[model samples]
Target: MAPAKATNVVRLLLGSTALWLSQLSAGTVAASKSVTAHLAAKWPETPLLLEASEFMAEESNEKFWQFLETVQELAIYKQTESDYSYYNLILKKAGQFLDNLHINLLKFAFSIRAYSPAIQMFQQIAADEPPPDGCNAFVVIHKKHTCKINEIKKLLKKAASRTRPYLFKGDHKFPTNKENLPVVILYAEMGTRTFSAFHKVLSEKAQNEEILYVLRHYIQKPSSRKMYLSGYGVELAIKSTEYKALDDTQVKTVTNTTVEDETETNEVQGFLFGKLKEIYSDLRDNLTAFQKYLTESNKQMTPLKVWELQDLSFQAASQIMSTPVYDAIKLMKDISQNFPIKARSLTRIAVNQHMREEIKENQKYIPEFLPR
Candidate 1:
């Protein structure tokens, strides 16, 4: 039952889609899964994660219909579908808006299908209506950058008028960051699913230099982070924004949901949870592995050392280049012990006497000759 509560976003997503999802075959979901995931990465601003699913991989559309049909008694859930259906959301950025650490945080922490944002794509989902309550967004900022709180509030008002024309719905109740670090947070009760599908890896990573701030807000209960004063690592400086918090009931009419729940079949629910975590883990691990390789490469830049000898003719430069080039490569290996792929690829493509001699030397060194 408690887990059912976790499905608040799940309810909103499934409840609203009850109409359309019922009309399609389960295979439609299966076919669209990879397509939408790929697209979500491309268009983080489009809220594809909140829409027609990307969430539609299961064969349980009948049960979703059944849940809406049966759970009509739960009045709070009646309108929970709009966060998904309303495609064009008002996203007003705060802080050095140029760097949107906040938007990325929201995407990673929820069931939404958003990736890092350059967020210009507009074709993912479409909406023709204004926000339900006339205005439907809260003030968001990097909590670490609120030194000029008064100025930011002024900016918020200006942002509401001059910017993308979304409604600003809440009074600021700046959240306390438990970690004492700097984080971009939504002060409003956006009610992101308690633990994002990727929270497991994000959580594990948080312990290690804890790059991720464990995003733990459930449906209806808005939560925030503890952040540092500067960009990162230090404790967050909490200053009172002195504005009132938004009314909890305001979200009562705000509807959203995830794809895992009793509303779907048991197989669907289990797979939704397990599959998302597994896929998310692989994504995170692969990223880390790539980073490892990148670091191992030590980001070495192969300088055009020959350029320094520009006055020399091409033939003269080419003649002495062998010894210097050999020296440079050997020095790089001695220092970093890892050859970047580009260097390796280039070496393999054009192996020379220097390379051949070095390989033979390495083989000879590995089994050193006995002292006479």
Candidate 2:
């Protein structure tokens, strides 16, 4: 490890070891299968892991807002009996967008070569320290504790989490009768987690005598934010996924006296796409509910939160409150009230603009236009 990374390891080891051990001790059977990470986020209710979720959770959710932005107006011209027609159209298009993103970015989870940063980190740190007197092909994170790494998964976890070890054994049978096969499992968030949570389940499954070697990884957030999507509360869930299994060619037993670094060249990208699909589905459900709410004229709806009200939603609400139908002056006055805050934010963006910025002011990537 580099000096900076070494320093980070030193700090974490010195400062966080106690905290880590305490959390490990505190988890009950069910709670043990879950880890929690608070990555610059605050959720009001359930701390479900999409139930065994991960990041890009925020980044994926942000697409909901972006999807709203691209459409200039709703498609229906006040003639549809089905309130969900517009919502369904948006959902369908959003699904297309999600698919496009996946094909372009996230297909790597199934790639032949494995790439999991968290497991690498865990193993690296373990190598730096200790792994017991003799053990084949597995790092001992803690020598004091028992490691249960085989068995049927009835199962899954939550934690301050990490890198994707989205690997599988390719020749999986329907009965999945492959005995003693090593399985790589990863649980990560944008913040902390523990591989130990998986122990109880794996140990229980092992006792049943149907077993495979398990390589479990629990990770915290990475330095990079590339995987996640962020917008508002509108998009807030990660779809769960299990990656493709490794074929015989991809898995070769190695001895200590060999240089295997040359084969570690392939890169995996966008293992985070399923998380986006989960978020979009969640958003679609919300829009479906919103459409149903619109269908009823006498329904007294709950007041919308500021986070729930987007610029367009605010515009629509303003239009509905107009003195006369489609009054021009009222619309102008309603929208103009936002000028003060928008101007301040725009000024900040302007001040931060570099003389030689990579993306130009009118670039299609963002296509942001400031009001003069």
Candidate 3:
């Protein structure tokens, strides 16, 4: 079907359902019967409008599940052309049914790129008026103050010259506006070599403005750390030796490490571990909240389906947390070797135990409906 026709069908269905539900809510028996008959005759195969009316007539968990299932099925069928209004309607109704469901639905809507409905839903839930059109908000990643503006501009010019072949072909100057300034700095910091990795993913015809937007979004969200670790991390990890290996006398003289040095090493190790634990705790909390939302709507989801979504979230969190976990392990190992701490073995064991507990906690977020 054409996109317009499909949209019309959805609008008509929603309008009919709303009218029927409103009448049912007011306890107008005649009006309710009249709307139901009209919707039944209009959409014979799909009785969703009438079902929604019945759900409004007597709200219950079972009825709510039926309504959600019907909406889910409709959404699946309407996935073509990326039309998401149907899903948005389901989310809107889901919000009305439960607060958590509403928030999750908003998340789901954004995931599917249903920006319009998601924005509308957010305004309604937030109880705030909408911002004027063309309004924009952004997050900035602070940069070190060591480099002067002119030096940074020169670096950006060099970076742009190198990146132009891969990103855009023609000559173009970076925008001077505040909105795009951070993006330019990020691109400059990324350099040509690192930005080349994105060449395959980015289209040849993509404009500089589009690239700027993409970079801004990436810097703000940074959903996956693997890309950075694999690309930029590897580049930065290459060691540059300033001098030859130390002689025996130099090594022997450095061996006279102090008690204060050892204490400082322990403190650094403790700080690294503490930060790792905090990241783990946040991942656990997010998973737990999502799991609770899933469990509450268990009647509407299959075990396999639940596990699929749960696994996706787990993998994303794990990917993001992987860098910190590695850093902590490396810090512990480095500190253990440098200091004469007798608790090195015990600390290793404790770190392993903490990681095990974190992984176990992550597993708890998967709904019990999935296989054990």
Candidate 4:
């Protein structure tokens, strides 16, 4: 009787293990196919504005400004309507202008790879450059400017305080205060610099996750691709050693090792290990590919890297925010504060609020201009 029962138990365990393994393989295969499809679709269709340098070579300043205004309007419309088609048109036009010399040259100056050409293209369209006096309506980076860093900091703090409760509650209200406008404007105009500053904090030994949380609140409604691409640049700076501390390698390895035994515990561990190994492998491959991409692409890749990081973060945030969870709110808040805007900080804040609402209401995800 005992031998018969033992045999039965072993059979059951083996059956269960087989089932689990099948599911794991199926899942892995599906995920890979999905990622491949996404890349194939996005890469082929995306306007390679950086490489197509001649598109906007001789566009007049007035025309450039008109294009930029249209881009801004399209971005705003996309935000309001959550429409993918309009955004796609915006990208087509924006890509053309960004490839222009005046617009894209600044991209080379900054270590940023992806959006410099876009910025330079916009610059060329403006009749004027960054105010020679270095005093914009938002931020004062000039030696002649008399605004105190403390004052700017105070304004940021106030804006953050005003927006925090609403960000979590899905009841966002835009700031109308005159002083607060500068803070928002600064964020819009210097988004890259703000982004760098935000990550610089994350890169610090004593990084404050709360600050990142604040900035995220304002930028949360933007497409997921933007966030995903944004973080890739800083991720390059994070060491494997630091990541290893965040991961449990020994347990993962043990789980990955195939279990010859026909038992429940062994089956569970093996299943877990397989999943972890797959994740580890994918990340390793991504990093390897990224390095290769950088070496081959050279300076042009800088803007691409920045955009990639933003897209990564954007994708992650979109999922989190869709759930309307507390972590999502915290993340949104942090993003809002972290990435300083060069032009439209208030707009970003408004967009974040709108996204939060859509997420809470289970709105459908809109396809972005780049089709990611």
Cα lDDT tens digits for candidate 3, 122-167 = 2232222222233221111232111122343334334433432222
Worst 10 residues of 2 by lDDT: 45-54
Local error of candidate 2 at 141, Å? 8.4
Window of ten residues with lowest summed lDDT in model 3? 35-44
TM-score of every model? Answer: 0.16, 0.16, 0.17, 0.21
How would you encode candidate 4's per-residue C-alpha lDDT over 112-142 as one tens digit per residue?
3244334334333221313233322222221
Tell me, by TM-score, which candidate is best.
Answer: 4
Q: Mind sharing the TM-score for model 1? A: 0.16
User: For candidate 2, lDDT tens digit of each residue in 164-255?
Assistant: 22333321111234644333232212112123344334434444544332433222222233222132234347678978776654354342
Any idea how many clashes model 3 has? Answer: 0
Q: Against the unseen true structure, what C-alpha lDDT does each candidate score?
A: 0.32, 0.34, 0.35, 0.35
Return whichever of 2 and 3 wins on lDDT. Answer: 3
Candidate 1: lDDT of 15?
82
